[model samples]
Target: MTTTATAAPGAHLPEHLDFLWRSPEPEKAYDVVIVGGGGHGLATAHYLARNHGITNVAVLEKGWLAGGNMARNTTLIRSNYLWDESAGIYEHALKLWEGLEEDLGYPILFSQRGVLNLAHTEQDVRDSVRRVEANKLNGIDAEWLGPDEVAKVCPIVNVSSDIRYPVQGATYQPRAGIAKHDYVAWGFARRADEAGIDLIQHCEVTGFHVGGRDGDSVTTVRTTRGDIACGTLALCAAGHSSTLLDQLGIAAPLQSHPLQALVSELLEPVHPTIVMSNAVHVYVSQAHKGELVMGAGVDSYVGYGQRGAFHVIERQMAAAVELFPVFARAHLLRSWAGVVDVTPDASPIVGRTPYDNVFLNCGWGTGGFKATPGLGWAFADTVAHGRPHPLIAPFGLDRFVTGALVDEHGAAAVAH
Candidate 1:
């Protein structure tokens, strides 16, 4: 197989030359203006148009659509979380994914093959147990698996009695699998376009014409190309949401982290499910095209840079070879990186902003790909009704200020 330096899963597109340099000439007022045309933004437009009859919307992308973290992900989808509220919401997302193809009239390649979080130590086993218990409370199918059971699920994994980062056990959920990331975005984009939503590409949001916190809430937004008078605004701009928030004088409780992902040439189908290992700091799975997708920890510092040094790549290789010995001979195909918008506690903030017409759907840290539908669905609900969804209310920006974060460090350490 081969690898390529493709654009990030989701990114902002520039506006057309006719729009203006950095601000459009207040063309038209949209019922809702979604910043960042990633999966979240596209899904939001689809739901608003498809479900709520709010078709007078505009999806503003600073770059090509879905050019950010949405396309950089390794496509691991699972709802096995450690917080009842979070687990509940993610489970809701899982349900939406189950019917995504029929809902969008397009294929998402949603597979229920399952995801395995390998436990390399006693604490890993304990954490798996805790996640299982927590997820069970929210009606998730998270099962604790011992070494033998792990082998039963994926015999290719060296879950034997002796090994580096020996397999003590694992956390397995049957309902998690992979999907084509770009396809998901295109599917939603097609539906949203069909519903009469203007996909204004190449539009950079430089600032907003904030008319105070009272009525006329955020009347217009000044973009790199032109100004758009949007009735409501939803920020789904991963890695760039904070900048957009700052433009509106909104201080978000989020940190930006750059994550790297690599893919190999198409090989024989050896991996069916996603496998995550914290002890090795690497999670890998084979894509439908048969390329082994590999990802590991992030850099020590946080920045918007999307390149890495040999040091990081070397460490990733060591972990991959240790886990799958055959990979030792595999040639290096391609490597790429993305700037992920992370929260202090590593959980996503997906609900409302202080401004009445502004909503937030970012801070996904390491797992935004799986929550694309959930974030869009909940965020759209917030924008449409001018109130936060019960599931997303707890994840408001106030959580960090109020010290009410749902700290799921266990999952964040590896899987996220």
Candidate 2:
């Protein structure tokens, strides 16, 4: 693998880019075939070679690498949740983010500047405090901060009593922060490429040919490139998982919704730590380039469009100005939307389907970016052993059937 100088924080992309991965043609067959070339798929391919010694792999993307939801996330990373299962997987991902740069031999710009999930009402305070305690019990760093402390951490926030949603308190995780999303994806892609895993782009999987004694295994993956036989298949496609599942004649309990986010023009550093207000429906973090990256809840309707309703963006900007009064003057630079596959429980589905040799890792909703590394590790293990990894056993498709959902709607710090 080639080593390059770490880009300075918030620096613009270099005029010339390093060749990260190869653009290879699809092979006739492979030991394992993964659909999706976003962070999860790339990370899974990297670990499949580094951990399990499985190199005969192919990751197929409908578009360019990381061009889907991976490119359109707010880039907030945290693991403080109300439930044990939620805490486990997310905290694991936080640990991986801490050392991802060193492990990948690449610069990911992972900044652990801390995160504050704000509480506005009495009930919000109670929930935030309970989540903090739950995080401590699980050996994760967490704390409860009052309005004054919240101001000390982020002075620009409007913590006064006159606001519609006055600040009561917040759950603070000192280890939680943000990273350069594209850099993280490139780091994983480069390593997987170095390991000889095929990162094929512009190759959409149209359908699958299933054949086995019980007719429950995928024999070939029909893609735009051509049909390729596979020993096993894994679906890591985020928003389009349901569409792909439909091709296999499998009913998935997943709904796709548009999640919108926007950034302000570059300016001097004004925001420090990450601040998220679920009650008001706004989350804000200043990027390395000095832009205020902000996002809110998903659109109510189900749609595959990569853009959101104007009313949603208007509401998000209104919430931002109310919380951070200073942002009222900040000019809107650009905005975008990413389709997310949400489940009823607001948790990811990461396990087996009816097909014996096919696996799934979807239904992440708005929290997919944070779970990339952790999910990649567990999903790769699950695909290698042909069983649900213990870390992801509770997230199988049978959960909906058996009433074993890992519900995280309230604790997720965002509306699902």
All candidates' lDDT scores?
Answer: 0.79, 0.87
Model 1 poorest ten-residue lDDT run: 17-26
lDDT score for candidate 1 against the true structure: 0.79
Candidate 2 segments whose C-alpha is farther than 4 A from its true place: 1-18
Please give the RMSD to the true structure for each candidate, in Å.
Answer: 5.2, 5.4
Q: Quickly count the clashes in candidate 1.
A: 29
Off by over 4 Å in 1: 1-26, 212-216, 410-415
Q: If scored against the real structure, what TM-score would every candidate get?
A: 0.92, 0.95
**Model 2: per-residue Cα lDDT over 133-190, one tens digit each:** 8889999999999999999998998999988999998889999999999999999999
| Candidate 1 local Cα displacement, residue 414, angstroms | 4.3
Which candidate number would show the highest lDDT if scored against the true structure?
A: 2
Model 2: lDDT to the true structure: 0.87
* Model 1 / residue 377 / CA error / Å: 1.2
